[model samples]
Each structure stands twice: as structure tokens, then as C-alpha cells.
Target: MAKDNSRDTGKNTIPKKKGRQSAVCANPLYPCAMTGAASALAGISDMGVIIHGSSGCYYYADMAVPDTLHSTFIVQDEVIFGSAERLTEIVESVSKLYNKIAVINTCVPSVMGEDIKEILADYDTICVDAPGFIGYFDEGWRLAVRELADSIPINNSNSNTNTNTDAPLTDLSKDSKGNIRVNIDGVCSMDPFHKGSLIEATRLLNLCGLKTAAVFCHDTYESITHPSPYSVSVNPDYNCADVMNRRLNAGARNSTDSLLGPDNVLRTFEELSDRLTDTEDAEIDIDISKIESECEETDEILTKEGDRYLRRHDPPRVAVYSTYAYTEFACDMIANYMDGEIVHAAARNNPPDSDLNGGENPYNIGGICSLHRIKEILSKKDFNLIIGSSFEHAAFPDSAFVGLTFPIRHRKMLYDRPVAGIQGALYLMDEISETLENGNKKSN
Candidate 1:
């Protein structure tokens, strides 16, 4: 898809990466304060957060994750310089109203040079700086976990406290087997898939008497102090894993597939179990080969559907707008299934780059800054298929749209259906099939 932005004929079109180098550069800001607040609130013994920003921020927050617990928000006046004062007032008010551990989260104010720490330093309650500008929303969740961990009083005399309080597992340099904590990453209010994942992860761990130190999500920050609680991370992401590793000495591992899948969960547990076992006879009973076989079957289904779609709608152009990890997997699988081409892809600049190397159709467009641009690109051209969150409306305002879930917040990857490995291939094929059928009707 192409849009005619006013061209600078004499200058290079694509912006250069890294070479514009000065010796130093400021790191990107966190994505949002609400993310951190969600993580911290999840971890507290009994906690709720007071978001200090516009009502829009709260609206997005409400939609971001599951409300397993109660949450309240306080909209601040942009004209007011001391919104932090309003935050203090809300904290006190919420503390009395809810009768639980309370945290006050500063929103964009965090980047505007607001002194959130100084405002809450004497409040006798937990207050964290959750600025969205510093990083992605996931990072916000992790920072909140760090703040919640800091809030815990590590009473040295209280020997009963055997939780992870010292440092992240990476900092301690402990062997993977000896370490016994697992941190779940990619937490935000928008997705609750991790909740089911935690249950499954715990169940698998219990088979070998292993325990999860904690289940970190938009909630689950209190466990940050209990380094021993986590042996490895179940859903590690760039946004939060490093903090857990370097600061808490907790083990951080991710799901086998970045996209959630139950088999991946089972395999992870089985591997951990085999590693934890000292006996020569101990072996993993969960056959990963079975999962692989299942994945192949799903792939076949996807291939069939994709081929069918292409046969009817030849040489289909497709665009994907999603998280980097999830999008790469989705695009690769779809490409293989259809034996077609992906003309464009839009995603965030999250890492480990291996996620994107689909081996077939390489992604042409990288990350998009605004959804509006996506809309413009899609509107100007024609793509037979689009896989993404509903935000594609910005790019293709009039195109028929369907939402595709990548297990970002659900407890299960396919939310009860087998969607990972080959199951995911089949599930995605079905999703696209439905979209194509519906999309064709509307387009015609």
C-alpha cells in the first residue's frame, strides 16, 4: 500500500537506523503508567490503583485487561500543575473507601517532570511512577512490579519471610536448575490469557512438586521481592524480564511460542520437571512430538483454507498489524499455509528479532508510528487479507474488519481451543476463512 506524502526529491526516503549517532542517546520512555499500576496491584496482598490522568486513559485501561478485582480512576485537570496533589487525595480517599492496599499511579505526568515520588514519599502508602512515555505498555507493567516489590518491607528479623527479596536471578548468576522461581511477563489490563496460563503452569509444576514463586500480570508485583518464589519466567518479554533478572535474581523464562498455546505450557513444565529430577529414571512423559504432529495437522488445514482463498482471490496481498512477536508468527504461518505473499506488516519494535524471520515472505513495512498511517496505507491500496487488532480502522476506515487474538491477555493461548503448534495453524485458518467469506460478501 502506498500514500503520496509530499516527496523530498533530493533527500533519502528511508530514515537511517543508528548511524545518526551521537555518542549518547536517551532511551525510550515507558509505554504507560497504568501498565505498571496494573502489575503492582496484581501482586499486593490486597490492592487497587488510582490512575491520575484523563478519563481516556482510564477508558483504555479498563479495556486493556480483565477486572478480576475492583479498580477506580481519578481524572486530573490538565490545567492544574500539581496533579500529584490530586493523586495524594485520591490515594487517601481510595484507602478509606476500598479498605485495601492502595497505589497511586501518575500517567503522562511522569514524563512531564512531575515529582510523583516526592508527592507520595510521606503518604504511608505505596505510590509508583507509571509513565507510558518511557516504554511500551508491557514495560509499564514490569516497572509497577518493581515498585510494588520496593514497597514490601523486608523485615530482616522476620525469618518467616522466605520469599524472593534479594535480587533477580540473572544478578545472582545461579544455575537454571537450582533457581526455583518463574516470572510471567507481557502483563497489561488488555489481556488476561496469562491467568489461565498461570493455572496451567502451576498445575504442571505441582506434578513434580515445583512451585511458581509468583504469577506476574497487570497484578502480581508483591512477589517481585520473593526472588525464591520464581525459578524461571513463563512469559518473559523485553519490557520486564531484564528488571526481574538484574534486580530480583528471579528466573525468567517465556512460553515456548510467544503466542500462547497449552501444549507449550505442558512442554515447558515437562522440561522443567525433567531438569529438576535428579533420578536417572525420571523422564518427561508429555510427548512434544505429539504437539508437533498436531501443529502439522493444523498447518495443513490452514494451507487448505489459504489455498482455497487464493484460488478464488488470486495473488492475495495481505497486511498484518500486531505485536512484533505475535505478528511474525502469524505472518509466517499464514504465508506457509497459503503459499502466498505478505506485502506489508505493521508492528511495534519489540524484540528478539528471530520472531520475524518467516523464511518465506519477509515483512516489508516495519513498525508504524500512528494507526492513521496504517489506515492511509491500506485505504490507498488493496490487500486481500488483513490480520490485526481492530486498530486497522485507522488505515482502512471503510474496509470490513475482524479482530484476531494472539493470546496477549487471555489465560489460554486459544482461550480453551488448541491454537498453538498446529492447532494454532488450524484455528487461524478458520479465522481467516471466516474473514474471507464475510469480507468477500461486503466487498462484492
Candidate 2:
């Protein structure tokens, strides 16, 4: 990136527009490309991220990401004289501390145009060009992961010996052909429900006689040599594992659909069953039975207890503030559990409206969605039981809320709780049920 020795105007700048619809709502609560890169890099246990920008820029990005980020405070003097020497000094100093390092270029340093590759040529580091203004979080993280894939030679040399030797890819390739070797791709440990999602996918696969080879971002170590040809991505947006799946040999399923909602999650496992076994009818039957049982258990609890609560007090209007995929997923589950209608749903990031319509309205409202926009919609259409992150929870203190996304800091999560699969759907039913019952008790 070129180094510019001038006043930076775009660091926290949000271009003003005519209305809420017209307003440039590029940066929401979600991370920019730089933050996504930094946060994603931090998931590599002892990996360190060096933010190549001003302290102010670093601070804002650092807030959402839990990892401790490294930064050489670029002052006015360094910006004027060029901070090449200073940046190298910090990189050298910080390199000894981490097993790996990612130098992330934010808006300021990117505009300044520092040739980082030449500077860090000698060090064991990966320089990522993730200008904050260029893209959103999804794009940023993909670039970082892509860079990680390109630079980090994942050969047997530095392979984590500690990695589970239960289902070695070499042995599976030779013996089983493709019976059990499965890798869960896309869902990184950076996500709030990532750990839980990993556990659920592995658990479901194991139940169906499938042995998970590895989870790309969550797994111990990923080698340059593709471990397993067969792979599944948890998020449709995430493509790190998908890219590797293309080069895989025969007898591999390279589908990259998300397991965000229960329906898709069920389909993901079914797809795996088919790939692993030629005659998977028995396995599919057993899997379907388990899912049916789980759904039944949720229904019994809600029907017996939930109906009583609604009888005493009117069902509250439901509103979900989440991503498009997650919103659809949660809305489906909520509709199944509650009699009350889903009045409103606001997406943090929207996939084009043309695609969403599909000749039918999914009722997704987006575009520079601020607190005011949310309130503006809510005033016209009253809602109850807000389902989203802590931000929405704080905004609607009067309404019953559930932690569905990020900033779930206050809630004490005992186990790795999921919000995706059968268990996740049941968990939501339980949470909503409890909230309803409690509200009834208070009212009585």
C-alpha cells in the first residue's frame, strides 16, 4: 500500500446521504475487512495480529474482537517521515512473542502505501492488505484466511503433532476410500457460536458412523496437502475450506452450503451420510428418528407449558435483529414454537433484495439500519421479545430478549450452546418458553 503523508479523512468517516435508505451504511456493528483479518488471525492459538495504522483506528476495531492486538503507535512525525524503520522494529520485537504474526494494514497505512512485503521479507510473518474502507467483515476475513492459506506452508514440518490421530487422512485414503473422513469447513472459531457449531456437527456426524477428519479454522493444524477431499462448510459465506475441496480427488462431496438453520443443518448431515456410504438408508432412518425425537420433545414442552402462558397473557409480537441467513433460520424456528407472529426482522448485512424476493417477500429490512431506523419501524409496528445480540437487548429493555449473536458477554454460557441444529432449535424453544412462563408469573 502507498504511504501518504497527509491528513487521513476516511478512518471513521461515514458518507452522509439523503435518507436512511440513501445513507451510506457501510460500517455497522460488524467488523471491517481489517478487523475481520485481525480477529480471524487471532484464532490461531498463539498467533499475533499487528495493526498497521493509528491507535485510534486500532481501538475501534479492537472493541468487537476479543483478541489482544499489537500496534506501533504511528505518530504525526512517523507519518510525515515514513514509518518503515519503526514498523520493522515493532515487527521484529513482536515476532519473538508469537508462533505466527499477521501485519494487517488498516485505512491509514493502506493509503500511505507502505511496501510491507519487502520490509518483512526476512521475518516469519504474513503481511495482509486489508484496507478497512474497501470491504465488509466477510470479505476481510476471507482475504486474511486466503493469505494464511497462501503463505503458511502447512506441510508435515510444522504439523501439530498434538492433532487427534483418531482418523488419519492417509489411512482413510488407502483403506476406507471415503467412508468416514469428513472435515467441517467455513465456520471459524471467531464466531460467537463457532465452538458450539463445531461440537454439534462433529456429534451428528459421529452418530451417523462418520469420523470428522478436521475443522479448518478450529482444527489443530491444517497442512498444505489437502487432508480430505470430502468437506462441508458451516457458513455459505466462508470459502476457505471450499477452495481446498475443489482440488480433491474422486469420491468427495464438495458442497459448501451453510448449516445455519435446522433444515439446512439436517440436509448437511444427510449429504454426508450419502457420501460416506453407498447404502445409507438405515443410517438416514436412524438420523431422521433422532431429529424427530428432538423436535417432538421441544413440541411437548412448548404445547403443555407455553399454551398456558399464552392463555393468561396475550402472545408478544416477535422481532429478530440478525443477518439474513440467521433471521430466516430463527424466524422458521420461532414460527414453529410461538403462536404470535414475527412482526419485524432487521438484517445487519443484506444479500440483494432481488434474490430475497424470489417472487415472495421474506420481509427483510436493511440499509444503514441504525437505532433510529429500528425504532422508526418498531413505532409503526409494535413488537415484543426481541431476538438478537446484546445491543438490541439493551435497546428494548422492556421486552423479553434472547442472546442470538455477538456481545453475549453478560450471559453465563456454561457449555458450548448452539443456535443452529436440532439441539439449537430446542434450546431456543426452551429459552422462549421460560421467558413466557416467567412473564406470566409476574403478571399473575
Candidate 3:
């Protein structure tokens, strides 16, 4: 976990703030709590998700989440009376199609004060009261994870035993082939790289002689509920294994290691290899050399590309705006590999005090969600390169840009591209180098 870099009294340290202030302003870049919950829950292939809110709320979430989503579509008539009938109608309809159903409450429906659990008492369903007014996307995602964890019956006697319920949940501690399984968390459907990240993480785990277990929000309901005790994350910011473990009262496992950057990927895999090797009583066996060798090759490629870029042009003075994890990774890559200067770094949401970066935030500001704030920062900072979403690109259309976060509208992504593994590191560097070189040429 990251330490408290906010307390550093260094001259270069940027002042830290608390919570998101964009709720008070307009044009907030991040999604609301309701959308976040929908994004997380909708990822389960066998779980049908219903957004219990207005049409606008339902539409926004439906568009943001790539997975299929149902909605109560409560109108003013339901609001005047109660949305119980509408919610139940949708839940009942969706129940027939899925093994499990999850309902995410939006701002209006949350304030309705109706007992959603009681309304759906006849059916086995999960209810998460994630109103948009409560907080941002991360909060809603956490709430859904907690609810999902609570629904599963923890069996201490035999971890592999099937539930007596009609839907038999599989124990994902090991696959049919007897390979050790590791859950992959932080696979929210809203993230553009979610699919690619899942594939990359699974590949890396397979390279270490392990198979993937549950993939947080992306797997089936049965698999998700019975994930392996151990887990890893592609995006640490949206990780839910810790929250799930806390809810399950399962003692902390050596999980939550992230594979966001080259250094992180190497360190995380190496640590996993050592732990698996040291467990004498366990049936696990892995070669650490494979992980080391792959990382060395990736590092060589990055070094060569980075050097090539530097030889052609001076390192870019860059500003990054994204989630805390991505911001940290981008800064580290640019500053260390490309020898660029981080003029400004801003996180769309307020990052947790501790994270995988060990609290070493290169951010000059945090909780930057407003368009006005982004424009203000861009106008003041003398950055030639911008690393963020389309919002940041629109804020300064002249600067060299790389789309690393959500809402990347300027370009089309036809392939499953990652921003989390060995390929991800190389992919990011490739974009940065090409974008910078092109921008320089256009200027000349």
C-alpha cells in the first residue's frame, strides 16, 4: 500500500485536498455513484443488473456500461406514489433471464425511502443503495462489492463444497486442471481497457503456472461469489478484494498487488513466485525465472524506445489528469523512462491516502473533476504533452495528447488494448513517443 506522501514538506509537493468538490460545480468529469454501481454489477455475465431510478439515470448508465442492463424507469407517477411496483416489475422480469439479480438505486429512488429489499423479499436478489448524491463511482463500486460479498455463504469446512441453493456456485480456489487460481479484481466494464487488462493479467498469471479464478465484476455470479483467497489487481483504484474479504471476515491474504507498470508487474509477480515457492506444505510450484526474464525483455524494449525518442527530441514537460493509479503510473513512466518533467499531475478523484505507489504521488493537485479547474490548470502550466481523457484533450487542443483514462472520444479502439501489463507499459510508451514526435513535427 502507498504511504502518506501528502505530509511531505518538500518544496515540490502539491497541496492535498479532501473529497470531491465537483458536486458543487458543473461539468464533473467522473461518473456518479449510481453509474459506478451499475458499471460494477453489470459486468457479471449471469447476473442481471437493474438500475432503480429515472430514465436519464438508466440511459446514462446503460450507455457507459458495455454490458446489458435493465432499469425500473420510474416516472413522475411512480415518484408521486412509490417506485416499489416499477422496481419489482423490472426485477421480476429480469429474474427469469439471470441466475442472480442486482438492483442499484439512483439519486431519486434512494430518496424515495422505499424498502427495496422488502419489495424483492420473494426473490433472491442483491440491493445496493448507491445514489449519485452519496459519492463518486469508486464508492458505488465498493458498495456493490460489499453487497455481493454479504450474499455469499462462507463455508469453512470445505472451501470447495457447492451451495445447497438451486444455483450451484463453483469453488474457484482451483480449476479442473488442478492449477492454483488467483482472482483478478478491478475489472469494471466501464473501463475501456477492462477486457484487455483481464486478458493480460490472466496471461501473466498463466506464465507463472497459475490460472485465473474470479474476475471481480467481469466473471459469472457463481465464480465471483466463490473467488480464490488470493488475488491480484490490474487497476488498484477500483480493487474490491479487500472490501470483499472484510465483509466475509476472511483474514487478510497476500493479495491486492497491482500490475499497472513494468516495475510493479515485476515486483508483484516476483513476490507471488517467492511466496508460492516458500510454501512447503502447499501444492504450488512456480518458476520465478520466467517472470524475471519477461520483465527484463520488456524493460529492454522500453529503454530502447525511450532512448530513441530522447535522441530525436528533448523530453516533454507533461501534465497528467486521470485516476490516481493511472496518474502515478504515467508520471513514473514519463519521468523515469522518457526523462520528462512532470509539470502538473491531477487525479480526477481524491486518491486513498495509501495505494500501490507507496504514497509517492507526483500530483500537484487532486480531486480535479470540473472543466473550469482543468482549463485553469492547463492555462497556468507550461506543458507540451498532456496525458488524460478527452476532457483534457479538449481543454488544450494544441498540446500533444495521450488518452489513458475514460471517455476517450477522440479516437476509436477496435482492439483489446491494455494499460496494465508488460504490453500495457510498452503500449503507453509507444503512444507517448509517437504523439510527442508528431506534435513536434507539426509545430516545426
Candidate 4:
């Protein structure tokens, strides 16, 4: 990010495009990303997200985390007429309606032109105000976590809150001596499943004595309880956690670059466990010999398949496109695992000349360069596999494509399978292997 926020362009608001799809910005601003990140941080059982936009954004979150439940949603009608009052009413209603903790997230439409600060100020005494457009999903996540952290009075003097309900999700043992306060960051959809990575993440953290304070996404409110001095980001990206760490006077670390592959996932768990548990030699103990051996066998099959058909047959150049850096990392991992080259990696909605001045985590990769340049690169690139969401596939229909569970669509549950860790590894291996095999058959 290189632009100065102080430079106020009078017409600087994101301009609306002209088309049937003109009502929305195909490239989401900071708010959407933040909302999604915050939701990811909030965890699964005790968190809920209210997208103060149209139904689409809420659906987006739902699709982003299929297993994560969004208990509440405020629609466009509320957004159009300054839904703060209704928002407050809904917040109060939600506070009483459910037993779990709740957080409200605003959308671009709610904050793009309106003084949401003023609107939220009135309700400041009552409920937290999550302005959507202040930043991207990571920023929204940071704000939500900060608000949630602030909401819970941090009493480091007390070892543990004996109140079972107040215990962090990582504190399942309910022991005061072992209450590890952990703030999770750098979470995104994995090769297999997003929530599976999260589940595995929480498990590893618990093993390392770190109590998860929050799991951001939908309906996971670990943020309020795990107010420790250290925040651990499980993924390679740590923009959201860093922002929260700064605001909360804490330290942070990003464990690994990608969290999808079994090896990467285990490494992340090991690194995070070391950081969060303050341990020296506690390596991850997942039994991966079987998976690794299987991968070797799969590699052999791929080699055989390649020789039978794809070898020297003009390997399909691929472009794995998305706005999420972690997602891009996932594609990178897949390409690396399969010995395929990523001809082009795109960040879909990154603002040009974006800056990271110790603010919310600038996690996505699109901000690396201009969209036109990315488009130009794509136009000239020769790609056969366009593996991402349908939205990404739409941009390159000429290529053979396989859609992942991105934000815009529902998890089709094609085979009732999870895709993170070893499962995710096998899924891609199967996809590419089958694709190569089919191509061979076609060629024959």
C-alpha cells in the first residue's frame, strides 16, 4: 500500500460501474474483507455476523464459511434509510434473543457515504459499531476483535475466569494455571475446507496451552476471553492479528504462508504451538506418514499419467485468481504440490496504491499492483486450468476450470468431504490427476 489516506479526493468514493451488475462494486472495498475476517476471528459456536448491506453480503459470509452459522442478518431496507436505529434495536433484540455473544457488522452501502461514526456514536453506549467501509475484511475483523476485546474487561491480575461460560474456547480444561490467551489470525478457505483448518488450528493451539480468544468468521466469539499478551496467526497472513495486537498492546506472529496441505498445516500448528505455548521442542504430532506415503504414490501415478498423456504435451498453464492472499497461497501450494506453474496469480479487488501504516492487516495480494496490469498479464498468459470460484472462472471460460468453495457460492457438498489438511491435498491430487488422465484419453 503506497497511497496516503490524508489525500482527500472529493470524488474519491469508489465509483459505481454501468451495467446490470452496476449496483455493487465487483471489487469489494476494505469493509467487506474486514467483515469476513472479523467473522472468521469470532469462531464458530459463540459468534454471529450481521452484514449491514443487502442479503448478498450475508450470503457471502455464509458461503465463505459453510459450517459457520450467522445467527442474524439485517437487510438492504435497513441499510437504505440509516438502519442504525433498527440496527440498535436488532442488536438489543439479538442480545436477548440468543444465549451466545453477538457482533454486528456494517456494509459498504451503510458506510460508503454516510457518517457511520456519528450513527454508531449514538449506540456506542449500547452495542459495538462495526463500520464496513473503514477498511477491508481484515480491518473489519480487527475492529470487531478490538471492540470485542474492549467489551470484555481485561483483568490480567486474575489467572482465569472460573465462570465456565466465560472460559475461552481453548480453555476446555477449565484450569486457571493453564489458561493460555490466544488470538487467532490469518485464516482463510483452505484446499479442503476453511472450517476444518480452523478446527485443526484450535486443537493445535489447545495442545500448546494457548486458549483461543476468538475465531473470526461467523458466530465464533473467542475474542472477548483470550485477551493475552500474545496473538498467534496460524496462516501466512497476519494483517488482522497484527492490527488487533497493536490495538490490544500485544505481540503477534504468522506461523506459515499456507494452511491447506497436511505438511503446511502441521508446520503451522507446530510453529503456533511453539509461540503460543512458549514451548521449545513440542513438534506437531499428527500421523502423516500415511498421507505422505499416499502423496508419493499419487505423485508416481501423476508421473505415470503425465508420461501416458500430459508429459511434454504442453502442460496447461494456470491462473489461480482471487482477492484473498491465503486463497492465492492455496493455489500456489496446489501448483507447487502438483509440479504445475501458476502463470498468473491475481488479487481481484485490491485498491491501487494501497498503504499499510501499522493499520489493519493488509492481507490480500491485489493491492500489489494495478488491476489493469493484472488484466494485461492475464490477457497474454496461456492458461488451461482456471481453478477458483465461478466468479474467477467467469473471467477465463476458454480454460478448463474447477470451482472451489469461494465466498460467492454455496458448498455443493459434492462428495460429503472436507478439503483442508490431508483431505485437501488428496482432493487436488485427485482433481489434477483425473484431469490429466482425461486429457490423455481425449488425446488418444
The top-ranked prediction according to lDDT is: 3
Return the TM-score for each candidate structure.
Answer: 0.65, 0.76, 0.90, 0.61
lDDT of 3 by residue, 42-132 (tens): 8889999998988899898877889999988889999999988888888888999999999988888778788898988988999999998
Q: Output the lDDT of residue 150, model 3.
A: 84
C-alpha local distance difference test of each model: 0.47, 0.60, 0.77, 0.45
- Candidate 4 has its poorest 10 consecutive residues by lDDT at 5-14
Candidate 1, residue 58: Cα displacement in angstroms equals 3.4
Off by over 4 Å in 4: 1-44, 52-85, 99-139, 161-185, 188-192, 199-224, 227-235, 238-258, 266-314, 327-338, 349-379, 405-411, 414-420, 440-444
| lDDT of each residue in 1-444, candidate 4, tens digit only | 443222111122222231111122223422254344435443545444444445666666665444443433555565566556665665555545344544444455446455544555543321334544454454444455556545544454543432233334333222356454554555543223455556655654555445665443322344334334333443434334444334433433322234455556555555544453453232323333443464456556545654544455555566655444444554655455455666755443332232222333222233311233344456777666665555544555455665553433423544434344445555655665565445422210
Clashing pairs in model 3, backbone N/Cα/C closer than 3 A: 2-355, 2-358, 2-359, 3-358, 3-359
Off by over 4 Å in 1: 1-45, 54-56, 63-86, 96-114, 123-125, 132-139, 149-184, 192-213, 218-242, 251-274, 277-315, 353-365, 379-381, 394-400, 405-425, 441-444
Q: What alpha-carbon RMSD in Å does predicted model 2 have with respect to the real structure?
A: 7.4
Candidate RMSDs in order: 7.4, 7.4, 5.3, 8.5
Q: Predictions ranked by lDDT, top down?
A: 3, 2, 1, 4
lDDT of 1 by residue, 182-250 (tens): 444444334333444445445444444444554444334444444332233334442344444344323
Order the candidate numbers by TM-score, best to worst.
3, 2, 1, 4
